[model samples]
Target: MKKILLFALILNSTFFYAQELRLLRGAITENLIVNDTVNETYSLYLPTSFSVDRAWPLAFVMDLEGKGKAAVAMLMNAAEQEGYVLASSNNISDSLSISQNVLIANRMFNSVFNTVPTAKNRTYTIGFGGGAMFASILPTFINEIKGVISIGASIGNLEILNAKQPFQFVGIVNRSDFNFRSMYDTKQVLNKLKFPNQLLVFDADRNLPEIETVSKAFRMLTLTSMAKGYLVQNDSLIRSSYNDFFVDANANVTNQKPLLATYQMSDMEKIFYPLMKLDSLKESQKTLKRSTSFRQANRSQNSYFLKESFTKEDYSYYLEEDIISYNYANLGWWNYQMQELNKLDRSAILFEKQMSSRLRGYINALISDNIDYLAADREPDLEALNLLYMIKTITDPNEYTSYLKVISTSSKMEDYGTALFYLEELLKNGYTDTQTLYSIEHTALFRIMPEFNEVVEKYLKGARYDVIEQ
Candidate 1:
């Protein structure tokens, strides 16, 4: 028994160590005249690899406060895992002064590249909340940036800038965010402009599910073949393609029913709800203006409601744009969520809810066995099981059960671990089918004790037993 316990402890410890992350801290001395004095402060993170000779692509992340270098470390770990380089810095100043922001960004970039010269021209920038505003404006000052990602930040007039230079841009927004309206409007404007940008607008109405969807989308973008274009041209089509890929990937895992339902719900709430409200407000305003008697009877009340709704709707749109800025600002929440979701089984939910078409497709691949669509290292296993659980709750049980069968069959050989894991999960959730439970127990026992015929016979005769050939 002690040996068994020791073995279990060793296995668990090995798993934990396999996922351990290491961080490194250092400072850069750059000549930036602030208050007529050249001062310097240290920035920190875990490099892609401990080796100094290997040059990795960089991601410039701002806004590190009490959060320490965890955000940068998360990105660096992801880069290391995904075979990229990320260079990040802490923009020490506060407030959204563009000049100050640009100066800090330039100094950080130069300082980071000076330490790792091979990172030049392969750098990307991510700005979060207020820092997103910095990312939008910083590009105008620095010519070396290859792409930009912004979250929950205000964009202002940044969309009007020329994107002919082939810089990729990705924006993440939430409808419940304070600046949601502005962000949505910015997305509309950018969509109209047809620049090589991708927008992930989430429904704030549902909290956990929405965040899960967003995180999944982000991961799929990183792990799939579609990421090649995202890394290169930053094309919207490529982004869209990735979205579709995730959707398909999830479909294969959960039988497409749950994803379809969630996609429909998100579209209704995130995309259509505000538009419907705006249309109603517009009609009400027109009617109130045309009818003098009605306007006179309740002028103040009518005007107040109309103006309030209109303003709220407008702000919702604005938030879409600003949200991207916040993402770029390197806010702890955004980075933390990314790190946490990356470790979970339901990470693909984040992608399915946030991305459409190709983006959705990329997420689907993460949970699927279609090796052609997925990278050599990426596979659907524990993550797919989590997605299956989520969909099982949101969709019809019978339909979900049938869907589960299909997924189990498709992934039976390659994903036996996930199947057993999810089967136990289903039992925990009150799915008490005797035959199914017995099958799961039998299969698990067989894999561990192939010579235990007596145990197999006992399972076969048990009230919860089922016989199914793999």
Candidate 2:
């Protein structure tokens, strides 16, 4: 396999790279100045099992912003458990083109590869959300990135995907993630292309994958390594992981989490098929599916998935239309939709709750995507950003940052009335970061106004500015 051989090559890279590399083993340390000219940096984690004698597999974690430390922290436990070297860049940016980001990631890769004895053939790209999207495509540009572990995103940069550069892809997503359907769809495409891949559907938000779920993804990589002869097959490790996963899936079924159990069965089937015959696994899968509880749960989840897809389409169409028209009047409609989501979230049925959560997440992601794209322009439409931020406040009510952005944008435009209104709305909705309110850009004069102080005093009991009654 092209993917297998690529990883096998990394094992042969010389000791020239290892002796010079100084690392704090067993803990992640921020490599503050890996590339000084561009000020590129990364967070590196060396498992306690790491040794200088052998080159180790590398997980190059990609963060959308310069959050290398946090990203590495997310996977550090799994890396420790799996004995993979972890490096996450602190320079990937949303403003950069896919090519530009890949170039930046490559620079970080060079820094790590040269400083650390990483198995060149076993290198993988890892990311969450936008970072995941970026990670999935890096293999196309760089031949050495042999696999992609994407949490919360499906395959990306499709136009550039080269069949010759095919790599192992392990996609991890939650059932309620907006990307759930897309991840499944990508599975079909990967199957068609004969790309070695697995999709693990766990139960959590896109950003909150449990450590067990993440470790399972890494385990798949290691097992692939064994299959490729890069590492000696450890049947004990295989049995232990398979048993852990099987127990979790059975626990899910026992807990009435049929959707999660079924998804786990699929993951189990793909992950172990390369290592051994899957007759027993297949039989277990059939037995689980044959259960009336599993059947009913599967039907409900599928129905909700369809409904969730359509609702997302509606949200996208309306959001685009509203953004194009600057339709402030439609704010009420958006608010109403959020209210409807709340109803679903409160529904007695499990499927409706899942669908509602996904829809809420989808709309927020949609608006945030639009906001980022618009704000990246040299002459960004401030009005649209403000509108999207307002809608964000409705969809994700507790994200105080959205409320602050709306206030800042409105105040910058001298729409004091609008700014003051959101100030009150934000406070009414339980925002109490008084210091942050005072520091919002373009709100210096706005924050000192009588109405602003009045609203602040009314909600938080102490206004920074003396509100002189007019």
Tell me, by TM-score, which candidate is best: 2
Candidate 2 residue spans exceeding 4 A from truth: 1-21, 32-39, 468-470
Which pairs of residues clash in candidate 2, taking residues 3 or more apart in a chain or in different chains? Answer: 6-121, 7-121, 7-122, 10-120, 10-121
Score every model by TM-score.
0.41, 0.89
Off by over 4 Å in 1: 1-37, 47-50, 64-84, 117-121, 154-156, 203-244, 248-470
Please give, for residues 1-470, the per-residue lDDT of candidate 1 as tens digits: 11111111122222111212222322222222222243543344433243444555566666534122544553444444444444444444554365665675676666555544344455667656655555665655677876566676645356446766545456666633435445655656766665445555544443112334434333433422233432333346444534554454344324423323233233323322322233542343344345554344345433533543563443334323333342223223323433442353243443322322222222232223222222233563433343433333222233336334523542444555545444444444445445544344225543333222223334343332344445
User: Once model 2 is optimally superposed onto the true structure by TM-score, how far is the C-alpha of residue 165 displaced, in angstroms?
Assistant: 2.7
**Model 2 TM:** 0.89
Model 2 per-residue lDDT tens digits across residues 1-470: 11111111223331222234346677777764565578777888878766666789999998888789899998999888888899987888886787788788888888777666777479999999889998998888888988999998998866667777789999988777778778888888888887888888876534578887888889889888877887788999888888888898889888988767877888777777878788877997888889899888878877877877788888999999999999999999999999998898788886787778778878888888898899889999999999999999999989989989999999999999999888888998888788888999999889888889989999999898787865
